[model samples]
Target: MSDQLVMIIDGMPHTGWKEASIARSIERGPHNFSLQLSEIWNTEKQVNRRAIEQGMSLQAYLNDDLFMSGYINELAPSYDANNHTISIRGSSRLGDLVDCSTTGKAFAGQSLLQISQSLCAPFGITVHVDASAKKAANQIFNKSKRLDLGEPIWEFLEELARVRAVLLTSNANGDLIITRAGTGYADVALALGQNIKTASGNFSGRELFSQYTVSGQQSNEPSVKLESVDTVLPIATVNGSGRYRPFAVAADDDMDVAGCKTRAEWQRNVNQGRSESVVYTVTGWRQTPDGRIWAPNERVIVSDPYQGLLNAERLIVETRLMLNERGRNTELRVMPKNAFDLIPEVESAASEGFIR
Candidate 1:
């Protein structure tokens, strides 16, 4: 059976169509898809409109394997004297979590799994936390004057993931998944003159700080200070005095010197990696050597002399796939594998609730 792309709307599978594309972008949030069909070519225009109005479910599959499943969230039909077509767009079940809000609720001393399950239960979504991930109790409120939980459920969960240095994403089956950031690596390598059609690398230290000093101040007391430095690049080589980045944390019921320090260190590492990133546009959907589909949060070796990178394995942070009249292609945004990986010392302390 050859590879095929199809979209099912209201229980009807559509393979032969004018155009279709699925974009799974974990870094920017929920994955989404779009389909465009001509009115004269089929009856999808009418069926799609009815589905959109009635909020019918939609699912997409590649090679009969489910890739994305969600409800039809948008519909735009067009018609003229010489043309007739309809456009449909939708997002995964994670979109519902982003739309749902939690009000007048407080979650204290609850594990990440518990919080995620509680928030996603109302939307009929399942939560799956990686076994290797640390489950720590956190505090969140929806009605407190000091802490308002008026934001969407996804936003709340994202904040929780950020503090713990984990990643919150959805699988192709639309299950909410929480895992370590940049932990998955593919065996295939993306090499120039092999599969990569174009490549570019960017490096800059303008936003990076060689030294970070984090201070936590309590009521009428001297502030407790913690410092972290970017050891990847020496201060003497870059600047003698060292570029200082100061972070002040207001002491709260949950704030502590240790938590403040953890935040400072995580921020420093993130910024340092962000200072240098790469983007590669490849020829097809999968790596040439293994035919593995390109996905986010996976590491792949990139070899390109033009970009000054030779067989450097980087983390695939984002991926964009397009299949239309222009043909099929994939674009990848990558960064150092250690970009989001926390320092061993910081990771251990943060997992122990030393970080908020």
Candidate 2:
């Protein structure tokens, strides 16, 4: 057996999917052990070999799993030999696998290395002496960047210190008023907008229109529609590819410039011109002079940096965030790069049990 010690780094178990349907594979974390090798092999070779031979990812195989594993993986680690206190100044990993974070500290007089070796032994893990925490951190960092899937995503919500409004329901009474945390002002502005209800059960990202489904009894199954929108640029996007940052929008319905009365009326009233709010349903993108509608790849925003002039093809993969979505944050929210890598779902065929 290798002279290295191995210990099971306990971590939390997680499988990212709804329990009702659509089951995804379970993600596993790796084992963490405290090691202290004699001044012999280089740290670089040891860490690299551990990652490759074990066939584990840093975010997968080590760091993250250790942290998330709670009782097991997140165990307080120590190292020593001969039952003496070897004051460990610090601990770190080598090579590039640094997605998870580790904590270290300067130690006083003690024999920590001996204990580390003893504990690391019998478990099949080896402990090596290394001085650089940066190297180990790098190992976790580099590996996490390249991995396709990762830990669950959580969103942090802050208090609405500004005056805000909660939309009760779109059940027609429209007089829905909700009490908010903030006393007034900012919260008030977030209150009732011109038209916050839609035919669908979704709110308006553009801040002017609400979407209500109107497909008769089949309203639960949404029908994606687009109306024309001229003039002002849309802050959110219709692209389903969830790669875009704060501006990532996936609303199925929206109002347009023609019916965009709030801003227009404000401007008209300021100029003392008698005009109605100029808002309309968001019409589909205009046809190109070549007699074809814009392709999904055509850039909706020609000036944007990340999505500048990109086409609509990516919309197929956007996360359907918001409205009655469950959880604090929508688990459906996927990173843009990952969304495109998805494979189309296969159809299931009816197969009776095979008769022997």
lDDT of each: 0.65, 0.19
Root mean square deviation (Cα) for candidate 1: 5.6
- Reference-based TM-score of each model: 0.77, 0.14
| Clashing pairs in model 1, backbone N/Cα/C closer than 3 A | none
lDDT score of residue 13 within candidate 1: 70
In candidate 1, residue 305 scores what lDDT? 77
lDDT tens digits by residue: candidate 1, 231-310: 45432234444546454544333435665666566666676667668888876666543356678888887787776679
RMSD of 2: 26.3
| Deviation (Å) of 2 in candidate 1 | 4.8
lDDT of model 1 at position 228? 43
Worst 10 residues of 1 by lDDT: 138-147
Writing each residue's lDDT as its tens digit, candidate 2 over 139-231 gives 211111111133111000000101011111100111111111111111100011221111111212333222211121123432332221323
Model 1 CA lDDT for position 266? 61
